[model samples]
Target chain A: MIPPRRRLRRPPSAPWTRRRPLPDRVRRRLPLLLVGVAALALGALAFSGIGDGMVYYRTPTELAGHDAGPAGRLRVGGLVLPHSVRAEGDALRFRLSDGVGTVEVLHRGEVPPVFREGQGAVAEGVLGPGGVFRSDRLMVKHSDEYRAAEPAR
Target chain B: MPHRDTCPHSAVAALAASAALVTGLVLAPADAVQGEAQRLMYVHVPAAWTAYTAFTVTAVSGLAVLARRGTVWDRVGRAAAELGAGMTALAVALGMIWGRPVWGVWWTWDPRLVATLAMLLAFLTCLAVRRWHGDAARGARGAAVAGVAGFAMVPVTHFSVLWWRTLHQPPSVLRPPGDVPVDPPMLAALAAGVLAFTLLGCLVVARRVRALDAAAAAPAEHVSRAALGRAA
Candidate 1:
């Protein structure tokens, strides 16, 4: 007669019995945890120095005392000084004034048709060593009032 | 196949969108700086907002797909991404048209514009990868990773105007600090536009997801039927 197989007894203190499910659970969740951590890290890094790069729009008066670096570009909006605009070849020179301060502008492109003396305009460029604002682009600021006022003129 | 289930929000979305068009095109006053051309903002801003919303949906759904390994989430993610990419392209094109009249140029190396273009390209690539891959699961997993990783560009795009020397205008209505620079009426019109666009995007995505579900199920049903017939 074959000897009956000895019954295998489970050890209550065995590490494998206690830890098996935990590892399987951890393995299943590890990818998700990794993705979350990576995204969080990337977000933090991307926004870290955002303030330093933020370039706010300012009027001539507001931009008068501010010194962004030579390469720094900013926008100044205000009325174009009457008779302050002059064109030489392709370059245009003008002054933008906000009633309190006047910033000189030197542009090297075709000025927009709507841009005129005594009209509202915004200039975007870098500030030179002097008080001059060297602009590469000029935009005319036309309001509904300006359009309504145009037909009358 | 004819779609039997109609989107419940379709009528509401259509009504809201029509109202937004009227408010934006007729009721809203022209901008002081950009004049009539500024009207493009009504469409452009809303489109951009919708794109952002869609991409967020894509990312979330993508994450769900990976975690659950469900076809439902994968289809939702794909639909959202496709819609988001299209909206982003529309916004970019509208922006260019507006820029031509206001900024006096058709295009510029503005950081905001560049970032937005990059986002559009990245999402389009994600969709392409999903389409071309032969293995469904592998393709979906790859797309999910792309959808999630590509979101890193969204914050950058939104903040580029503030963070970089850009020709693009700064936030007027959405500024978080201080006061809203835009007039109340203008802000109201913009809000309406955003609402309409968001609702429209949701409707489209919902319909697309349902279609995808039907398509995915049909093949499985056919295969099961064929197996049963062979057994008989």
Candidate 2:
């Protein structure tokens, strides 16, 4: 042990040299390339994926049958469970369940005024530490006309 | 050592990547059937759509320049032509990445793929025209003609899907008589992808025009300055 420790203390010899500063042209090019790469990465992360892979939309029944893995972004689709929507200020919480299974969705965005329980809507985002689907983009799908219209009085 | 805006392509690249990210991560819907893997469609489809947009812009601009005569048309034609080319390259790249899983090939000579490849070669011909010609005024005119001729490839790419049986699925946006009804999330994602690409194309063209205008004014600066001095 003592001998090994002594050997470890003796640094492994290797040739090394300090590098000179980069010229202006090279210096300029590097940052431009770096920014380009970073932008690509950011786009990939924010939109496409952040390593784990891009989130996939599925019905609660499908999610119930499949392995979403831990920390995966999940797009859960199905009817907004009847009377399951409850809210506290901007946090609109509801349960979305296919006929067979259900997942709680916690979202902070404005609920489309026309969004009511038991309608076809899709909420997108990642799975939280708990089982809740944390949605960031919500679109309440209406029949042929997706754009929300004034509710009849 | 940092250059302004990093690299020459940084600005547009950042915008494209971020717009893609927003469409992919934030705006796009995940597939109801495929789940996370469906996210790939956002980039793949948009890349293809943007390529379409670029070619359309280039073709129209080239036609305008050929029909009329001005630096404005030349500039527009050039910017659109270059953008169309870049988008085509991006489309192919994203398509290959998506196809590996769904189609089992990195590339296919399928009608859609082949037509897109032709679109790319068409724009490249425009670049070639520019390279071969020396005088700015005459070069712009020559390149405009080439751009318009090359753009005929667009209709070829567009109809390739319907005209030939290929590995690629028929369009989901509007199905043929027997086309399956796509899941709601998929339609949403597709719409978002189109919108995002349109925004990106507009941003790219704007930047290209500004950069070109600055470049064009550079060579004739001494002449313009002397003219201004004489007038004064």
TM-score of each: 0.67, 0.51
- Residue B101 deviation, candidate 1, in Å? 0.4
CA lDDT of each candidate?
A: 0.72, 0.62
Candidate 1 lDDT tens digits, B78-179: 989979999999999999898788767776555677778778866776676563344578778888888998877788888887776555766666556776
- Model 2: per-residue lDDT, tens digit, A66-105? 4443465556667788999898677889998778889888
Which candidate tops DockQ? 1
On residues B44-98, what C-alpha lDDT tens digit does candidate 2 reach at each position?
Answer: 7777777777777777777778777567878777877777888888888887776
List DockQ, one per candidate, in order: 0.06, 0.01
Clash count per candidate: 4, 10
TM-score of chain B of each: 0.90, 0.79
What is candidate 1's lDDT per residue for A26-132, written digit by digit as tens?
54345445545644654454344222344334578766786553455666677889999898678898888879998888887768866788977777777886777
lDDT of 2 at B56: 74
| Each model's fraction of native contacts | 0.08, 0.00
